[model samples]
Target: MDVSWAAFVGVVVLAYLIPGPDFVVILRSATRGWRTGVAAALGAQTGLCVHVALAVGGLSLVLSRHPDLLTAIRTAGGLYLLYLAGRLVLATFRSAPGPDREEPAPGHGDRSAFGQALFTNLLNPKAVLFFAAVLPEFVGGPAPTWAQVSILGALDVLLGLVAWSVVILAGARLGRLLSRDRVRRWWDRTTGATLGVLGGGLLLARD
Candidate 1:
């Protein structure tokens, strides 16, 4: 696989534009608080990196060998999305206060956020499929597979982090315009609905 800088950048751009769990989580977190948003972003990226590693290491090979398991994973991922969506929608009607409803109340307890982000991404089997399918496109035969995967993994983390950070920063800015409670409620509902739609979409997807 020959490495073209332009092609690589294009792939990254496209991935950024593609709507998925990472984007939804980042937007939700950022609007809530920078710490949570960054945490979720880093967490999701960590998961992506892990999936890339697994793909390069040929864990996907095992998965491929077991089509039933793969299907189960896909199903689970879809269900998880639905569950998250339901949670969000339920929260929309609740008087409860979650991270989203909170203010810019400062404190960079980013470790927790990072862990949550990482867990969400890691648990997402769709991300695993994504790495299996998309990661190989960037590599050439002469290049060490691990080396190519490493580069791609690094790119995934960097691009994903940067993209989510920008989103969060922008949300933070917009956050100042609305009352904390209103912003929180609006984002919660929006995220809940978005997650629901995404979940349903995922269920309907085939690949």
Candidate 2:
């Protein structure tokens, strides 16, 4: 693998700093549990692989030729982010206040957790399109594209896992102490606001 280590590091670092569906989903999972948190992270990363593959497979070439199309995709992604944020905000207000109100258990073990995580990632259009745009910049050719895509994809997953793990651990600790509806609602509102900001920023991004 003749990959550029510096380029790889830059990509990983930039990706970790950027706000995306994976970040939100992982944060959501962490507050729930390690099982669900890990599941959602892996699932979301797997979906990201699909996006990278599609981008490197030839779709990126088309996008490069037609920046307008890429812009359109990004616009749609921004809309999706707004929708997700809106849902979270709505959930915050509608949730009943009580100690009995708890997040549903994520299920038995790693398998269930992984499935839930995967489903959430695959369902998020913003995640898919975000990867489509970003990964292509790193992998800009058709030569040995699959191998290149795999390398970048691996780095992305690794970095995401590292970042998400920290979030999950912190969230789990905090969640244990403050297991109340009011706190949960506040968290939801904060998450919603974060999502909204990310969406707005992405919308303002230039080609």
**For residues 58-127, could you state the per-residue lDDT of candidate 1 as single tens digits?**
7657777876766666666667767777766666565546675543222224665565456557756667
lDDT of 1: 0.69
Which regions of candidate 1 deviate over 4 angstroms?
96-116, 123-126, 180-183
Cα error, residue 44 of model 1, in Å, equals 0.8
lDDT tens string, model 2, 1-207?
555778767867776677566677577666766766777677777766666667557655675677687677666666766776787787766637455555422232456546545654554445555565666556655568667777777777787778878877876786676566677677877877887786676689885
Q: Which residue pairs come into collision in candidate 2?
A: 40-117
Q: How do the predictions measure up, each by TM-score? A: 0.81, 0.73
Highest lDDT: give the candidate number: 1
lDDT of 2 at 39: 73
